[model samples]
Target: MPTLLKKGLALMLCWFVSSDLYALVILQYHHIDTETPFSTSTSPDRFTEHLALIEASGARVVRLEDAITRVAKLETENEIGPGPDAPAGNEAFQVAITFDDAFISIFRTVFPLLKARGWPFTIFVAPDLVETSAQYLTWDHLREMQRAGATIANHSLGHEHLLRLKGRQTDDDWMKRVSDNTREAERQLTMQLGGNRPLLYALPYGEYQPLIIERLHEMGYTIFGQQSGATSRSYETPKVHPRFPMGGPYSALESFRTKLSSRPLPIPHRLLDPLLGHAETRPSLSLHLPQSLTRTHRINCFGPSGALTIEPVGEGQYLIQTPAMLPTGRSRYNCTLKASDGRYYWYSQMWMRKLANNTWWEEP
Candidate 1:
């Protein structure tokens, strides 16, 4: 009724609405066992703590598909706040849990916990390994999980580094092989899981080049990468939708909370394409940050070694040169900045280096 009281209420509502506009994070997991190589595994106790923390945080845990659809719609329609179909109290921070590789631990461990909470998740499976690998989930196991509110999506046929071309494999041959591999996986999944699943793709080993992404785009599939950043409406296409990996050291509660609150750093669309380091194995990256992120002084970039060299290229743009040619493995360059709200804005790009004529790669 009073003018001053009405103005105060309006300001609070505006703050709430704006904050909810960018409230989304996608977390990727691999294994949840203490015995299965700690690099990709998180101890069961830690995993339990993770779920408990999410439950107590007052944040909604949504299905991966729901989060993706909402973000795509938000970017296209430019609508903010809860939509007409949105449920009550959904206009807050949200998270989507996704597991890759379809490890046995998923069905044995992670699936049960998620099921108990009545939460939804997505699992990316390499169809070729379903029955071949003893450690992987079998078709029956996956089918049961799917029946229990899980989304089964394609990771690839064999989960090979999709960007690496075999010896004497020409560009055309590589393209055909990749296309066939992807198509075969889709066929296999369709035969088993029915035709109602979403065409979501998770890159194997978190590696990809611009051309590979372009080819995937042409094939009509939604893509997700293992880069360490928060996904948002700005990343409307699957090509650049970054999902933070949550395993091993990253599964700790403190780090998990920080990552859960992370925001997507402003990266221009043209400059956001996947950059691959071919012969050099280590490539420099240039970024043109959005003007809204004026805290340039707080921006920091780091690689596998440590802090990287960040040199100003021009107004609101910087060049990050890697310190060394990355070893023959998966490495990433991560950038984070201090947001006005005290949470960090994050962005990451992954690199997969291959040895030249190296026997290690030729082994069966």
Candidate 2:
């Protein structure tokens, strides 16, 4: 979109903003087939229903890179000054739909659906898998999608877990290899697409430690994670933007609506926990939330194992912990506050717990 048109559209969105900040919901999926792994696949029929719901909600379906740029601008404007910039009521939502791993189902099913509607979307692909695996997307499919308003971005070469070290690999070697993988993936995307592609990367299986995130940041990339939350002031700006999964059991229409209605909680600063835990799988999390929310006592934090107890420590800092240890692999601590309106202000901290030997238990 042109700069003039983009600004005009932003003015016309008329969203329900919280704390003078605009929000964008990024929804991600892997497969669009019923035959693929159920945990990572949304059937074609369910996906169609999801699109119908999105259209009904009157939300703007934008390409991935454009969504981030819009949010960045909104955040900057709100930070500088605040006023009647955002309306005091309901309006259309802003959502960016993305598919990860570039499965054939996306090229076959998802492409035609969105193409017919002439709506824009994004696909995060591991270039190494293109045409190499029958289940994955081919370069021709990518070219076709790219021609039809789809933004192709990096998902790392080989789609391997960045957190898990290979056999006999040293810590330094692993970090270097991971960084290389990311850079090479982006290079391949540019080589294949032959356009001014952005350095957008989605973590393979959404696995990353603080170190991995920092390395990617140093490389000048905007990272996307599989954590469930809205993108707004809550996100770490251009780094590690959280995305809601839209597959498997999470494919329910009501659940999707609730996520679309969600707002970013007030966590602009003071969350710096490295979500990598080994021995202490049941790790503790601390957050510095607004005192006004603590006073309301309506803020609730939950982990996948169970509801976590939010203990107020001091000076607007709260200790969040769950009784049950998270199962090996990825999990999240989700905090939500019911807003004056019916919708909830939400934030999620993604965690990855390795096995006792500090090795990932399962492959993505």
Candidate 3:
């Protein structure tokens, strides 16, 4: 082989050797406007910069379906499958873009820019909100976007917190309601969009419990939540797959860069529970990592308050406890282990508080 061809082959061999370690980072966005009511809105200008930075970073932007399928396949197979947008020969770090709630701003601002980039994305919409809320995207808008290469999935009927039940609502009734709401959303999306509804489910408010997850699993839905973590082969969940939420303060390009460059830490399933209960804030999160990770001392876990307390339990097992009671709403414990090469291995667990102890879940 010529000198240049020989160099190319050597690089390819290196990629092949390390392909199993590659993970997918999924970035979640909610709105693309400056004045949206929710704190989860990314300004249009910042949204534009996000796309530019993602493109400049040389990360392969993939559809959400492709990411899920690729990660699921990677769990069983050692090789990464060449999905819709992935190149067959290279082991590139993949990033997928997703927007929840189907904001009109997404259609007005985000769609044009992403369409120009020739990129594919997924949008989860609550049909009830779309029907009644003027701020949300209408069925026609979603249909147009879908025709233009966006995949529309189910968020829920009214974006209610699916895990919580009313004060008097029995557990069986709550489960029945949740099931009906999801089926209704899927049915409406299929009716309006003229295709089979995608199995993708973005949990409303990024909150889920074991009961909720079990219900969703029975319905054959692939769940994605707003937790921060990279999805890798070792990341297996028939319940909830995590996507890093990027909105409001998180939309800054620097934070985006750090999140985009992070890798998934192979955490055993024992520590994967959501750990939610009434008035319970500080839950214990224990992780047992493989021995191959030699930087256990350098691993740091952080909550909304700051650095958490990490205690060594045994060989390759550590106990991480939240330093304070997590206030109401959704908060996460984010841990990162810095590698020698400067990349960080990431893991996160989400904690949710019921809206009120007396009545229906409180809205904070």
Candidate 4:
């Protein structure tokens, strides 16, 4: 009896430890106008309803910068200070509200509501668009929002997709197109706001290639992308932080709740691995599967020269042994899998670097 009791206590302790790594929801908004074809533009009344739902959820609303700062500090020091106005030890349930593009409506509509509630938010602006057109926020409006505690960030100069540049362009041309634009935008934002340059960047259209991500990192940006899902310990990357797009005509409170209650979409291993550039050096690869797969599944990793196969060792886990002759360097690899239910999944990521040891270690 005592042995059984001890085993039950150990299982409870394990559950407690696992539950401590709660997920963070970063909600993204763009435009907040009534006319955009995009389903994400939330009307003012609907946005307020969304806010009311968030409040009812008992989640603390934080700015994207604040959320990033909290995550970084937690990673570095293993602690997050008490959130402003948050209860002690309740930081895990925090949410970050972010707006992309300097829409005039955001300043005229959203900012007032946020300010009234004393809520924090992050706004990404394309410096070139500010104050130029009726659709975009003017510099005065942006400054007013900044004064009201909304953190402004750079969203590039022209909102161009950095990854779609012509392949024939010279390295200098590419750098000017990407780096120079960001630099100038930074300069303008600092000059207008009279504060330090914004460090956060939202990828245009939620699109980013690996090279663009590297360039943004070089330009001192620590966060990017528009992929939507709750962030947990396993999904850590500046290029693809999960953020649910909110505040559109279709962004009713019911829809928002449904999205929040849903589990993350299952990203295929084939689609995920190549983005990391791991195919060349470690010819073999493994994927962490969702918990519901009770039976083992086969994962196939294919390279230019040959193919390798992996099998699930346990639920949502697979192992692959690679060829010793696999050359080292950054190479894109593709993965495909067939589950027992006959559904096929595909994904890829970049493979870079070869480790001296093959032993598995826990990822931080």
TM-score of each: 0.85, 0.86, 0.86, 0.66
Clash totals for all candidate models:
0, 0, 2, 24
Q: What local lDDT score does residue 225 receive in model 2, on the 0 to 100 scale?
A: 87
**Which residue pairs in model 2 clash with each other?**
none
Residue-level lDDT tens digits of model 2 in 1-364: 8999997765443232333346678999999999999989898999999999889878888777777776666655654322222332332258889999889998889988998888898899998888887898888899988987889998999888776654488867887998888878877888888858877889888877777777787787778888888776523433578799987998888888888867666564433445465877677777876555556547789888778988888966888988887877778899987765566667888777777778667666
- Candidate 3 per-residue C-alpha lDDT over 9-104 given as tens digits, one digit per residue, 9 for 90 to 100: 755543433443567888899888878855788888888888888888788998878777777676656563332122323244788889998888
Residue 143 alpha-carbon offset, candidate 4, angstroms: 0.5
Once superposed on the true structure, which residue ranges of model 2 sit more than 4 Å away at CA? 1-20, 78-92, 165-173, 233-238, 270-277
Q: How close is candidate 3 to the true structure, as a TM-score?
A: 0.86
Clash count in backbone of candidate 1: 0
Q: RMSDs, each prediction?
A: 7.0, 7.1, 7.7, 11.5
Estimate, for each residue in 126-220, the C-alpha lDDT of model 4 and write its tens digit: 88888887888888888888887888998888787564453469866776678887888788899888765458888776655556666777666
| Reference-based lDDT, each prediction | 0.75, 0.76, 0.76, 0.61
